[model samples]
Target: MTLYKIDEVASECNLTKRTIRYYEEIGLLSPQRSEGNTRLYTREDIERLKKIISARDVLGFSLQELHRYIEVVEMLTGQRERYRSITDLEERRRQLEEIDDTLGKQLDMMESKMRTIQSFKEEAEQLRQQVREGMERLGRQSVERAEAEH
Candidate 1:
């Protein structure tokens, strides 16, 4: 049950203290408070912040999207816990369905981001192709001018 201060947590997570506080302000994190109203972070809180960082920086999720992603992940975690405790066949089936639904939401968000990245790549390739064509055209005109001069 190790507790960490905000500075320690930020350094461990490679984030600024203000960024960590901002995440808390946006409901993405909720570290416990100390007796003096200072924010105290647990190992779990640090882990959650790492996930938030990954979602925002690696996955390029906007704040709104990150909120939804965290909500789905939390729901799935709870559903998994409930699933292990349930014994009835119907209840287990329902739990599985809920888990699947949560997973689908996450997958949808990832797919949308992938599509956007792919679109950007395609546009970049088109621009590169146009540049290549323009260069080739210029080279041909240069040769033609030299020939005409000669």
Candidate 2:
């Protein structure tokens, strides 16, 4: 049971201490405590923080979104464990298949969300270009008007 202090976790993960604390405040992380009440993080906590960071940085997920994603993943994993423990062969097979299908659907939805994010970026870029072009045209119009008035 290797445990790391808050500072070590922050340094190893390249995260600010404040950010790690904020994740704890937001119910995203739960680290154990030392006998002296100091924050002691296990490997699981470190991994979870890294997972959250990856979701945020690589996938561009908002904090709320990442929190919900973690919750859903944990719930599904728990459900998987329960289904795997069933003794009856037929029932176990049915439950396992259902869980598998649900997981597949969840993955499909995430892929769709990624595609939507890409589309949003493209739309924003296009609108930015339009705004820039409009501003240039307005500037030219203003110059012409000033020259005529002179």
lDDT of 1 by residue, 1-150 (tens): 889999999899999999999989989999899999999999989988888889999889999999998998888889999999999999999999989988998999999998998999999999999999999999999999999999
List runs of model 1 lying over 4 Å from the truth: none
The C-alpha lDDT values of all candidates are 0.93, 0.87
Q: Give the clash total for candidate 1.
A: 0
User: What RMSD does each model have against the real structure?
Assistant: 1.2, 4.5
Residue 89 shift from truth in candidate 2, angstroms: 2.2
How many clashes in each candidate? 0, 0
Choose the strongest candidate by lDDT.
Answer: 1
- Candidate 2 regions with alpha-carbon error over 4 angstroms: 101-105, 124-150
Model 2, 93: alpha-carbon shift in Å? 2.4
Error of 2 at 14 (Å): 0.8
As for candidate 2, its clashing pairs are none
C-alpha TM-score for every candidate: 0.94, 0.72
